[model samples]
Target: MLATIKNISVTYDGVGKSFSSGDFISGRITLELGKDCKIDYLSIKAKGKSEVRWTERHNNTTVIYHSKDKMFSIEQFIIREQKGQDCNVVAPGTHVYPFTIQIPQQAMPSSFKGAWGKILYTLEAKLSRSMRISSKARAEFPFVSKADLGSIPELMIPQHGTKVKKMKFFTSGKVGMDIHIERMGYYLGEDLNVVVSIENSSSREINKYTLYQKDSFFARGKRRVSTKDILKELGEPIPPSGKLKVTKVLKIHQHIVPSIFTCSNIKCEYRLKIVLDVPYARDPEIKLPLVILPATQTSGLQPPPYLTLGLTRRERKPTRMEQHTTISTAPGAYPPTAPGAYPPTAPGAYPPTAPGAYPPTAPGAFAPPPAYGMYPSLSDFGGKSEWEKR
Candidate 1:
């Protein structure tokens, strides 16, 4: 009798590309045979595969596929990377096969931490029905993790923290570091053009560096990719700031489409930080404020956040106090300029969006510029017409 089977399910044990012990990759399979043809064995298994290669600069030593397979047990090699592995699934299955593989902490691949290339896994099902085989069922998935953005040999200067500290006894400060980009951004990935510079004003021959960064969206508690989303390079040394002017051109990939984003509030606007790695030293401490700037878009086009309200925001009009910036910060941090509401004779803003082009004003005067911060949050602006104009 001819037999048939379909709908095989596959699952991954770990949520992240990197995993520790105790995680299990499991799934199930179904089968059907000509009524009571007496079915038998069904087998399920998991496998992993990886291949890598790296070459040093100036024609130095090289490394290739550092890891191939590991002795997880007496006879199991974790079936690392099987391109032709299959599942011999069958009817009347036996043995649930509580498969649990070992994934040592060191097995975890990292960014710029030495390991590079892709790691993927698949399932192989073998079946024997009444001393015969029908077909095989299986599933495959990818484990992708990017490599480090820069080398470790060039790391020097301030390594971490946000403040630029200088010893009180020292009249001036001096230190430096270098940063380079192997690729401006990813080939088919969203990337940001970045440039960094550090200067030394002190006379001491200081040499150590640190780097730190806080992406704007995260600080504002908004929805965006985490700062750790991209790979970075913090190596290369820097000379005294006065002695050498260091400049690096590189790209950062968001690994997502439309990578460019923005976050703002009532106070000073914060940008994406291309933080530096400054090692600790005595005396001079150089502090730098990283700024995030978006690329030029088609003229007259603006991000939705810049002109509309998010799902969490409710529609509302500007309070008289908000326009004048007279509200108390103690009670509530009221904003300055209201969205779609411009200040009259504000001296230089495209003629105030052509007065009356927005919501109508109250009877007379445009209520002098609000006294708070001379800016408004992207959430401040909202209207059906505004969205329609797009």
Candidate 2:
């Protein structure tokens, strides 16, 4: 009888099977055997890698350039034979094996699909039989390692540049172009404002102008660049010594990845390229550097709080009367004593001595005062009070 891999099912921790770097992927593999079959071993393997390949035709032969990097690999054996014994022969039934693997966190590139390059993650189950033939089952998935923008503050700042080029080789006439942008950095779903001015002193007529946003990667000692056309405008034929100005807003797409800078072996960058097409003449091109950030970092595009109804906000200031009223209406504004009443002494305490009376002397106790001598005594007033004379 023949042994075969029946099916493979991969399950992740979250709601979907999709995962990111540093995530744990767990799944099960099922095998079916028609009859008793001897097997060398059963193994499951997981791998993540990136590959780039393209072919160029030389004089009569084709030259191919290929580069590949393995990000991670993990393998687990489900069944193995002893040193002196043959492979295990399983009964004709279904067998299930479970596996879990943790993806590496360091230097993990985001998944990509391109015309000549790809980053892929795969899981495979192998059933090694006694014969040369082996039954295998495989599955593929995507992983994303998000590029963070919070650490690089400069990327959020605005950037601008200008370039001037001659209309054709060995030509006296030149075309001066200036490109200005509202910011150097942007997140997905945001709009980028671009201002361009072209001063054409050349004799050739400007036919059209195209703006391209390109993502470039330098990996494995080779450079690969991909571009998406963001904006295009038909140039109004500029006569000799004429000028043209344009202002446009381009929307960033969510499918694009942020600029990558952490990896030494793999470098990713973006540029805004402007091409001015001249009829019957070499096109003049300019490149402006750009930084792409994560969509979550764009606060302006996020939803506002539920309590706010998306209205224009104004700072509210308290009036003088309102300020005074708040303080006056407070619960503990006044002291504990009643109005127009003397301040009370401590609880269960005695009052101070009278104006002309004294207290009995005792250790650490109050002392009695002598007769008045600073001013006229009460006897000098002829037994009448000073107030009566006044």
Candidate 3:
């Protein structure tokens, strides 16, 4: 009978299959058999790896360069050797098996997709049969390791850079460009606001201006770079003395990796580069560093309470005296004191005096304390009188 793998389903912590490093992955494998069959064993495996490869032509010959990093590899057996027989014969309609694995806690690079590079995670289930090829089912998912930008102090401030270059070789005068970014730090899927000013006093005509987001990768000491044009604007030909200003909002893709710092063998970073294309002249370029942050953490300039100093100070608890003092002086804390600094007593109630001292209480002589919710007199607390100090 023919053997076939029906389907495979993977889940992470009762949710979607997507997961991060150090997460527990659980899934089930399903198989269908046409008839009774003999099988050796069943197994499930998971792997996470990254590979970078490219081909270059050298003197009519093609040479390939490749590098690989195995972030993790693990395998577990769903069915092992049978207790009473060399192989197990199954009369199967459908069979299902479950598996669970824990990903390592070490920093795992985010999943990436490129023309010559990929960081991938895969799951496979296989059935072994003697003297024949094994039947297998496979599935692939993405795992992302988020980089936190809240720890970087420099990212909180705005980023600015300016460059001025003099035209050379037949072109005379100077061209200056200024780039200002709202902030150096950003989260994926967030919009980046950029302000650019170009002052041209040169004879060459400006063709266009382009903004590129570059991802630089260092793997096994080999460097690979990829760039995407996030913004482009056609430049109007400026006279010998003219200026142009541009304001743009560029969106960052959510599937990209944040700036990586934990891994030595595999490193990634991003930069914002501006290029001014000029006809018959060398293009002038300016690059500024950018920090991609994880969406799991809040982005943008947070209120001052979350700043570095505030974060550190938040850990300290206020002393008892400070708490009490603050509570005592807080507005609306105590009822307002009555006029003359005396708290009115209850109706027909006379102030207590030393033993053997007669109390004086006459009708229309003392006013009762103001109705509830009204200000109390200072005498309630012994301020010149018991009622006044109350």
Best by TM-score: 3
Which candidate wins on lDDT? 3
Q: Where is model 3 poorest over a 10-residue stretch in terms of lDDT?
A: 305-314
Off by over 4 Å in 2: 1-18, 37-40, 79-90, 130-132, 164-176, 182-184, 197-247, 257-269, 275-285, 293-390
Evaluate residue 308 in candidate 2 and report its C-alpha lDDT on the 0 to 100 scale.
10
Per-residue lDDT over 1-390 for candidate 2, one digit per residue giving the tens place of the 0 to 100 score: 353434434432234345565455666566655666565666666677777777778899997767776766655454543333432555555554444454544445556666666677887777665556767888786665544545545555555667787655655588887878875567777887778788988775654445455444444355656677655656456677888887766677777765544322233455666667665566777666666655652111121111111011121222222111000111222222323211234221122232211112223222222212212222322233232232
Q: For model 1, what is the alpha-carbon lDDT of residue 96?
A: 21
- What does the lDDT come to for candidate 1? 0.29
Ranked by TM-score, the better of candidates 2 and 3 is 3
Candidate 1: stretches off by over 4 Å: 4-22, 37-40, 51-118, 144-251, 256-390
- Model 3 spans with C-alpha error above 4 angstroms: 1-17, 57-62, 86-89, 130-132, 153-158, 168-172, 197-226, 234-247, 255-269, 277-280, 297-390
lDDT against the true structure, per candidate, is 0.29, 0.52, 0.54
Ranking by lDDT: 3, 2, 1
Superposed by TM-score, candidate 1 places the C-alpha of residue 356 at a distance from the truth, in angstroms, of: 79
